[model samples]
Target: MNLLIQLTDLSIKTKQLELLQPLSFKLYQDKPVTILGQTGSGKSLLAQAIVGLLPSELSQQGQVEVFGQTHDRKSLISLWGREVIMLPQEPWRALDPLMPAYQQVSEVYQCLHDLDEESAFYRALKDLERVGLKSSALKRPGQLSGGMAQRLAVTSATAGGAKLVLADEPTKGLDVSRRDDIIQVLMNSAQGGGLLTITHDIEVARQIGGDIIVMKEGVVVEQGSAQQILNHPQHAYTQLLIAADPRHWKARDYPMIEKKPVLEAKRLAIGRNGLALSNGINFTIHSGEVVGVVGDSGCGKSTLGDTLLGLLKPIEGSVKRLSEEAKPYQWLKLFQDPPAALTCSVTLGVLLEDLVKLHQIERQRVAILMSKLNLAPELLERRSTEVSGGELQRFAILRAMLLEPVFLFADEPTSRLDPIIAKEVIELLVDLAKEQGCALLFVSHDPYLIEKRCDTVLRL
Candidate 1:
């Protein structure tokens, strides 16, 4: 088999902190490989290392070669889009927020060949439709559901001709139907090159249909066909991973928790440019009540959020915040990718301090919040890009809590997280909201979350 990528004694470290141990693997131009690991096992770090996108603070000791060319951070510029493509764990990070999804995806072709706007957009539309995001072409990254945003990123990464594709959790945040289509797209794209997918989703790993590498603590414990590794995993960690899917977990009903209405939307119509995506929507969120808004992609779930947060105007309806003295972040909204809601250029420290400055938050209180959210104090020093999604989500929650909002609008808050971390974050949100009597407007495609966590659900 012709080699597309090779790693020789490759390892990753963050200032003496070993993120990945020395490991060797070979990827052929026509073969696809799945790397399975638990969260924090350095699966993502390994992908970054091979792609030459590791942060400057992190160091690597090893040789990485792509298509017979030795690669380092500087050397990658010569072969970026044409030879190597990386689909990040967080798709939002890979996309440009300032541009619409269509325009950003169109740039992929513009990079390789000079094309007119119409032709680039035509190609963008075709590819996006393949991933089920053609309808979201005009939407910005912020306007899409987590799953939609992920597909948009796929459209870009897979657009340019490349010899090898490295995807980290590409199927994350997607529903079962879309997940299958996306897997097929990535696999079809790999017909011309090597496809190495790093995912915690065992189902995703299985459906992609290829060799599997079981990783634990950055060590390759086992490598074999998907049938052997998934059905009969040799490694203990691999077995654990295979058993960790949340889809099989039975949903339990919970007693409803409801209180006085904190916010109410009457006859709401959500849309833009004199259009209504969904109309006649009426919902009321009571303080201490967890309300789930469930719908399919393009069902106006996020549009309702924008309308509620006053980010989008209601074509014909009214929204009332009963709480007096409305302040910033009071009706706080958390999207699947919270970092997009933050200022990418600023450090977490600067954002946190600015938010809590008026309240004169004490160090002790800050520590308490961080501890509750399971975040390290040092994370405050890093930018949004440096921290992982779960870490930044915790900080986003912390920032929202500092504002002491009467209500919180969470749109796909836990969709991007791992099964275990997702459970923890959702539980934490409920517990914290109950403690503060802050109403929750939860939107998710997972029906179980609505049944278990929310007191009542509003369907669109």
Candidate 2:
């Protein structure tokens, strides 16, 4: 088998800290590999180092070779499209929101080969069609589902003839079917170039059916066959990760309290710019209840959440915050995109301070809560741009949790987390919400999560 990518004594360090430590691996054309680790374990960082996509502030040492050839930065400038393609963890950022999906893919084909616009367009369409996105060629990024976007990214990799496919948590937030589709696509594409996927999902690693590389705290701790890693783990962290999935986890029964309505909407219509996306909605959310709003993409789940948060107006109906308190209580939202919601103008310290002041909470109490979430107080000094997506998402959830809102609107709160960590976070949220008697309305696309955690599900 021909080697596709080679890393020897590779380590990456940002200005403040080391991200990856002396990691070495070789990918061959016939055998795929899966790298497993929790959030901030440097899985994504390793991929970035391999592809020369790491930020300028971060520095690396050691050798990265493609097809046994080591190319310097100046010479490696032209190596990306032809030799490597990465399906980013945040697929939303990998694409052009302004361009249609098919067009963006066509541009990839056009850039790498001598194809006319007409030919490229048809080729791109065929590529996407092969990944089961024939109907999505006309849709923009915002219009496509998370799964569809990932498939399109895969199509671009295949079209570009990349020798080594790199995927970072490709199935993080997708549903069961979507995850299967992505894994199958990668497996099929690996018939030519080997695939290396970085993930936190043991299930994803198992399905990929490849050698497993287990990483922890910036170092590789174990490497073996995927099934061997799952069935007979060598490292303690590896055992913890495999054991933490909700499938194997046995959650303690949560307190389901019977209480009056904490939030209600009547004859509601939701949309922006006077265009209604969903209407005639009526629902009552009581304290200690998880009202899971499940739906397909762009079915007004987020619109309803925004309207409830008062960020957007309920076009035609009235929303009442029927809290048990005398003073008007606040409603907090766990946004789908925390980075976008958390402004970059100020440091996170300022944001946390502002939140503390607004809620009249002590600084120490906030610090304690941050500690419980494994979020450092030092993160307070960093901006959203510096935080990883999982970290940002957890920070967003922590901020909302500390506020103790009478009603909490969560938009895919666990989307960026792995199933194991996601399960822990969900349990914590449910327990805290139950303790506070807070009304929890979770807007999510994962039907499995909604079915398992939610007390009442409202499907659209």
Which candidate ranks first by lDDT, i.e. highest? 1
Best by TM-score: 2
| Residue 276's lDDT in candidate 1 | 80
Give one digit per residue, the lDDT tens place, for model 2 in 1-460.
8988888899999888888889888888878999998877899888887777888888999999877889655556577787777888877778888889888889977888878899999998887777677777898888775656766666666677777788888877665666787788778767877899999877789998769999988989899898899999988888888877656655367754778788889999998768777899999999878899976554578789889878899989899878747244457777766777899999888888887888798778787778777888788889999987667777887788777778888888877776666776787777778877888998765665677778889865
lDDT of 1 by residue, 104-170 (tens): 8789888776778889999998888787777778889987767788888887888886778888998
- Which regions of candidate 1 fall more than 4 Å away from where they truly are? 1-3, 13-15, 28-30, 38-40, 51-83, 89-124, 132-149, 161-163, 172-176, 231-244, 250-258, 320-330, 340-372, 375-388, 399-405, 445-448
Clashing pairs in 1: none
RMSD of each: 4.5, 3.7
lDDT, candidate 2, at 68: 81
Residue 217 shift from truth in candidate 2, angstroms: 2.0
After superposition, candidate 2 runs with Cα above 4 Å error: 13-18, 54-61, 129-136, 142-151, 264-283, 307-329, 356-395, 418-421, 445-448
- TM-score, candidate 1, is 0.77
- Total clashes in model 1, counting residue pairs 3 or more apart in sequence or in different chains: 0
lDDT of model 2 at position 238: 88
Cα distance off (Å), candidate 1, residue 60: 4.3
